[model samples]
Target chain A: EAGVAQSPRYKIIEKRQSVAFWCNPISGHATLYWYQQILGQGPKLLIQFQNNGVVDDSQLPKDRFSAERLKGVDSTLKIQPAKLEDSAVYLCASSPGTSGEQFFGPGTRLTVL
Target chain B: DQQVKQNSPSLSVQEGRISILNCDYTNSMFDYFLWYKKYPAEGPTFLISISSIKDKNEDGRFTVFLNKSAKHLSLHIVPSQPGDSAVYFCASRYPGTYKYIFGTGTRLKVLA
Candidate 1:
């Protein structure tokens, strides 16, 4: 079976610019999540979507980061006015249910100058 | 506060030896424990998992032991190989939830 897919394996942007990453989860998966992994650190959950509805986004930075999942199949995460601190990898993951091992995508590495 | 912790940042073991990586979690509600292995430039892949009720689970050369009383879990790799070199992370989730709290990771290098 195919795993989660993400677009633009790498990206570079200047500070204060806007950038977005896309994710397409595996077929029939019901839950999707976005996480940010800084160098030398574990992935930090940014947001979660159960179908087309959100499950949790408490850790998301509301001021500049936003995400959405359309029709529960594909999702996008955007960072507006990105900062240098935002330079990291954005990973997209999916699981068949509310409880299982999450399948991860290759991730998009964003480098902000 | 950090919910999960992996105190060892790195380890080196000779091939065919045993390699043990440790993790500690502060949340008592976590019922599922998992370990993931990651290679540079690649996303992490699931290695193994164990339920809270079980004190030990083994698959092939990998074994995971959970000590609820100490809130500690460990991953053991036996007969380690150079191919096993990579960063390993431990994660846990409470029952009925998919959101897992992950550790910082421990890098293991198996020297041939």
Candidate 2:
């Protein structure tokens, strides 16, 4: 079976610019998640979506970061006015449901200048 | 606070030897533990998992041991191969929580 899919495996943008990442989860998967992984650190959960509704986003940067899963199949994460500290890989993952094992995508490596 | 931690930043072992990686978690509520392996430029792949009730779980050459009393878990790779060289991450999740807390990760290098 195909795994989770993400678009634009790599991205580069200037500070204060807006950048967006897209994710298409595995077929029939009911849960999707977005994570940020800085160098030398583990991936940190940014947001989670169960179907079309959000399950958790307490860690998300409400001032500049936002995500949505309109149809429950595909999702997008956006960062407006990106900062240099935002330079990291954005990973997308999916699972059958809550508490299930997750399958990850290739991830989008964002470099902010 | 850091919920999970992998103290070793890196480890090198000769091929055909045993490689042991350790992880410690501060949370007692976590009921599930998992190990993931990741190669450079690639996302992490699930390797093995153990529930709280089990003290040990093994698959192929990989074995995971959990010590609830010490709040410690470890991943053991026997007859380590060069292909096994990758970053290893330990994760834990509580029974009812959907989130999984991950460690900083430990990089293992198998020298041939």
All candidates: TM-score: 0.98, 0.98
Which regions of candidate 1 deviate over 4 angstroms? none
Residue A5 Cα positional deviation in candidate 1, in Å, after optimal superposition: 0.9
Write model 1 residue lDDT over B34-98, tens digit each, in one string: 99999987888999999999999999999999999999999999989999999999999966778
Model 1 lDDT per residue over A1-113, tens place: 99889988999999999999999999999999999999988889999999999999999998999999998899999999899999999999999884569889989999999
Q: Residues A1-113, candidate 2, lDDT per residue (tens digit)?
A: 99999988999999999999999999999889999999999999999898989989999998999999988899999999899999999999999975548899989999999
| lDDT, candidate 2, at A102 | 88
lDDT per model, in order? 0.94, 0.94
lDDT of 1 at A2: 92
Which residue pairs in candidate 2 collide? none
| CAPRI class assigned to model 2 | medium
- Model 1 clashing residue pairs (backbone): none
